[model samples]
Target: MKLFRIVHPLNGVQRLLLTVWVGAMWAIGYVAAPVLFAAIESRMQAGAIAGTLFSIVSWIGLLCGGLILLVQWRARHRGLSRVALSCIIAMLIITGVGQFGLQPMMADIKAQFPAGVEMSGELRSRFGALHGISSTLFLIASMLGALAVWRSAPTDL
Candidate 1:
């Protein structure tokens, strides 16, 4: 009982969650997104599907990251806790901006110029700029997540 008490309930679960977060991110973003675009005849359809996947992945990231932070806190690993918190914040910020800010703006731009119509050059340029920013932020969050997982691992030393 004493030994079990020392072991947090979410000990190994944190590792699993972290694995799922990172794996899904890479698999969906890199592999599935491209495949979706290729398989789908319409760019709009492909974009919608990809965006939904990204949103789901972002939620998963938030859940896993939050739980991992809790686990780190329970372990009293202050440094690890800090790292986890930072990673979670980065993930949340990236996801929020992409979902709420960029996605909406892109949708508005697309709406302004429906299918078969030439999109406004200014709107197109703005959408492209937002896409680039979102992509960079997402990439940074993904890398931070990987780093957080590495730092959370048990160190034999």
Candidate 2:
């Protein structure tokens, strides 16, 4: 007995892209970030590695989110399309704020402090606050991406 239905080729492609994008976000944000800190002896080195990885993830997110939006826009499923659109927009915004706005400020703070100097001052407080906000935004974006993936998955539809 046949147990599965064939979906449009575009649906498969879209789902694959979304899965990879969401998985990468989780891996980079949750896994790699912590690993870098644990493995690297220097805080600056760990931060640099994590920053580079996050920047790459942000760019990949933009491309994948844009592609998902384009495909969903042309799809016949209006409700799904709307949901995907909203989630993608939110993800994009969160990524922009985290990567463009917060990351740079944090980097600037790091630069202000001398090497081997513990960050203990107004700069440290600001950096810590921005880092918290950035982390929260990344988590939110990951959840929103997962939502888009769920809405786009192929099954009965």
Candidate 3:
């Protein structure tokens, strides 16, 4: 089809997008976040910085995922598998839930406390629970992203 023809040449671009997106997920989640916590004296400040990084990565995932999905959908007949498509969709959904759903709830909890102050009691428990869920979701998405990158190899199809 015309769409496939238009998108066919984007195979390399799609792979590049996937690499960047997944690489960022791994770097920020595993590397930078931990460093921020360990190096920064103020837990609140460290958390704020890590949260911002996560938010940026989430946005990147959404954009790259959208574009990759468009390319994959258009070129589906050319060798791109449904599994790859499904992985991207799953990643997008996870990112959306983290960004739109869980992050706001966590933010609201944080907002209840004074600046530079650590949360405690019921608020601390609630925030911790939400953070745990968000972290689990992020980990799942990162794993899926790794799988997707592997599957995108030229010979894998």
Pick the lDDT winner: 3
**Tens-digit lDDT track of model 1 for 87-117:** 7667767767777787788778888876756
Per-residue lDDT of model 3, residues 4-121, tens digit only? 3333577887889889999999999999999999999998999999999999999999999988888766877354456766788899999999999999999999999889788999
TM-scores for the candidates: 0.77, 0.84, 0.90
Candidate 1's clash total is 0
For residues 11-125, could you state the per-residue lDDT of candidate 2 as single tens digits?
7667777788888999998899999999999987898889899999988988887777777677654435567668878988888787788888888998887887878878878
> 2 or 3, which is superior by lDDT?
3
Full-model lDDT for every candidate: 0.76, 0.81, 0.89
Compute the lDDT for candidate 1.
0.76
Among all windows of 10 consecutive residues in model 1, the one with the lowest summed lDDT is 1-10
